[model samples]
Target: MLVTHERLAELGILYLEGTSVESIDRAAHAVILSGGTRLGYERLLLATGARPRIMNKTVEPKSRITTLRTYADAVAIRSTLGPQCKVLVIGGGFIGLEVAASAVTKGASVTVLEAGPRLLMRAVPALMADLIRAKHERSGVRIVTGANVKCIDVNESCSAVFLEDGRKHFANIVLVGIGAVPNVELAQAAGLATDNGIMLDETLATSDPDIFAAGDCCSFPHRLYGERIRLEAWRNAREQGAAAAANMLGAERPYIKVPWFWSDQYDETLQIAGLFREQDALIPRVLGPRGQLLFCLAADGRLVAAAGFGSLGAIAKEVRFAEGMIAQGFAPKPEALANPSISLKLLSSQHRSSL
Candidate 1:
């Protein structure tokens, strides 16, 4: 849904595409910012997302080393690929794998090199990572984990990558999906305090109370985790935007929701419905040959989060009852979770409404 042009238009938010903010000045009742053009607002929100981090010391901003952050980036890569093309993807994270899968489906020879030991190592457990890697490998996508890209060699008509192990991989095109750095220069220039991301309170108000920031650019208080986190997920961004707007209108509601993220690669669709630390114990179960579910239960047995990679209905069911499951440490018996009644739509409506 993220890359879908239809969903992009459905959001209906004012999107100033391909523009970089030049400056921002925030006052009590009004704000002014420059993005190739000047924009004035009574109450301003900085929803500027992040940009992909380029690691190649040699690759310039405008080069064959492309980073996927917008529809244009995807379009550029799609238009450039042809049958029997070789693609070298740097960073085996979600973005990298998704791009590789897309290219492989279009008849490209894809290879993903991850600096870590496993794909999505930081986002999921080792076993889950193995499952994702296996799934991709079955689709003819070669995965090289624990491999680092030392430099990118771009010449007149071709590009190649040099790995730390002195191995070279030639590619018709190169895609760097290392990760993202928040677009907070405007907020920083306006004197807003920022650490990993823009620092904000429970009300989504920055250090400068006159200005509020949301989406991927802001970090705010999280009640469940008992700390502030910078979340870059779509659901978090949309909810935070609405919360910031409400607080600006004197509602003062704290932005408190379990951060959720989802990814679709080839035939596998993965959904994560809550937040859990690295140390959280995951209770895994296989519902069928095609459906798998993981419940992250706390030390006390409360369900902290649910991750699944087969059935959206099943995943949504568990997500809806997430609070009760978390608070009470409840885990459905093996047989109950297998039942058809555990649907995502029903559970989401029943459980999520209380929030």
Candidate 2:
């Protein structure tokens, strides 16, 4: 999704097309393609990524409703949206909000419908969600939460979204961004272990020792989180791909990098580092170069995650220290965290670990 064909060609990369791997014969150490081609390999890495999760099967045939997954999907969406176009976004996750913000920028009338009670319920804390919602509202976007979308009715020209609460929103464009489904059909057919994603070890190797996986398609044990997680961020995928490649070459290295993600809507830059989902409390710190800092602290007192909105320059700094604290399982007093007098560096140094 990040690279273009022209760029790949410029880098002297051999880009293959039309050849699809039908199945993998692990016993024979070969992959059979649809064109009756069999390729043998000593090691294999699966970076299959994911597909956009379908919110409703009934609306799959609707031409107005589009799921943002590929560059083509974005092109199709932009084609439908124009000035004064009523755009209805389903699923208020990252993709939905981003699409809504972009639609607003294009002079489209945007309305975001989220089934959950809060925006970005699974991704960010309630406080951050509130800030994001307010930010979008100020940008002239209508965000409706606790909206239960029953189904979509489509016609020759426009479509209407029917909600369970007896509300119907008519729109010329619909964007779905609920979640993603890991592309694990190949791994499942090959008898490799599978969960919500392909299961892998800390070394990023699948159950089959010769088969390794990375990116959004694989869930590996995280030594830091004490559990397994499948990160969908571009940075995480890039780092994991490199680590998996090195390990596939017989360099045994565990993929234990700290997890982080970022989002940009309007003029604000939002960043989250480490496991923010586990935080029990929010600590607001006002010691950044451009904006205030909101720290997500676990119940045990460690800074599990942190987000800085405003200057990308300052957010980069806070996110770095937050990563260090998360790595050492560092815990500081809430007062210390809220106090701007104590920098994140001081807090990290005062933690149990020397680093």
Candidate 3:
């Protein structure tokens, strides 16, 4: 899955090697490159992406205390990790949890800490978060939430994590997964409007009409949601990039793809479709030879999101149907959705028709 420079070169793309944009001169409608190259474009698309959110601004990461964001990070973790290794992971989000699970698999004793009250508090519904947290604990992953890390004492031999509540944890390796920061320095330097990210219109164009942005670096108005949202996922980035390209070419295409994301921990495949809130009504459907399928419905009765934990094939099959229901604002009957016997595909189709 990830597209490489060689792959793009094969696809008739001119890959500019070692070219860096220093600044953008909007008056001249050109980008100033570091190598004294001025590249002019009719329409510019800034897909800068994002960077990993480190533990602290004051503390610098060394061998023992670091983060897992790149291939090199994985290598470092693997090299240092072994049986009976005590690993301390900060943040109960997806990255931290995933890393903890992987460490546990490699026979490392793992402990994860989250500042928030619950795991994936912003991403998934409360019930789902609880279920997933319980599952992880059962699989030998120690999790702690509402933990305020005051300081970190790092030395060559070991690193100690100090909390404000007078708790200290010493570990062999520390992996931080607080979150990510949008790489918007270039956009900011170019004088484009930015808040949490580069602000984009429904067409994914930025404040400057000639320039556009997408992926994790830009926040665009959501068609289904009435607010501006930025999604950092492989599917979202890929789809938004294509949409931006089409819009830049004078083909008026609005990005209306329902938010979809997935993660794998151990043998289970967790997949989610559409954006779900904690207040959404969760309807669990027990299925055949698979785990439960949880559907999240908004207050207005529209099916907004669904999460599946079981067979990857079953989750993959349900993704499209779930997306359609959310995009169409289809409100499936609670009776139909809660029933275990009714096929999810059929339910979605019927609910969509009812709308």
Best by lDDT: 2
Where does candidate 2 stray beyond 4 Å? 1-14, 287-290, 349-355
Q: Rank the candidates by TM-score, best first.
A: 3, 2, 1
In TM-score terms, which candidate is top? 3
Q: Candidate 3, 318: how far from true, in Å? A: 2.7
Model 3: per-residue Cα lDDT over 277-353, one tens digit each? 65678887767666667898888898888888776876667756777778888888887877877777897767656
Give RMSD (Å) of candidate 3 vs. truth.
2.1
Clashes of each: 5, 0, 0
By descending lDDT, how would the candidates be arranged? 2, 3, 1
TM-score-wise, the better of 1 and 2 is 2
Q: In lDDT terms, how accurate is model 1?
A: 0.75
Query: Which ten contiguous residues of candidate 2 have the minimum total lDDT?
Result: 56-65
Give TM per candidate.
Answer: 0.84, 0.91, 0.93
Alpha carbon lDDT of each predicted model: 0.75, 0.84, 0.83
For model 1, where is the 10-residue window of minimal lDDT?
27-36
For model 3, give the 10-residue run with minimal summed lDDT: 55-64
* Residue 199, model 1, lDDT: 89
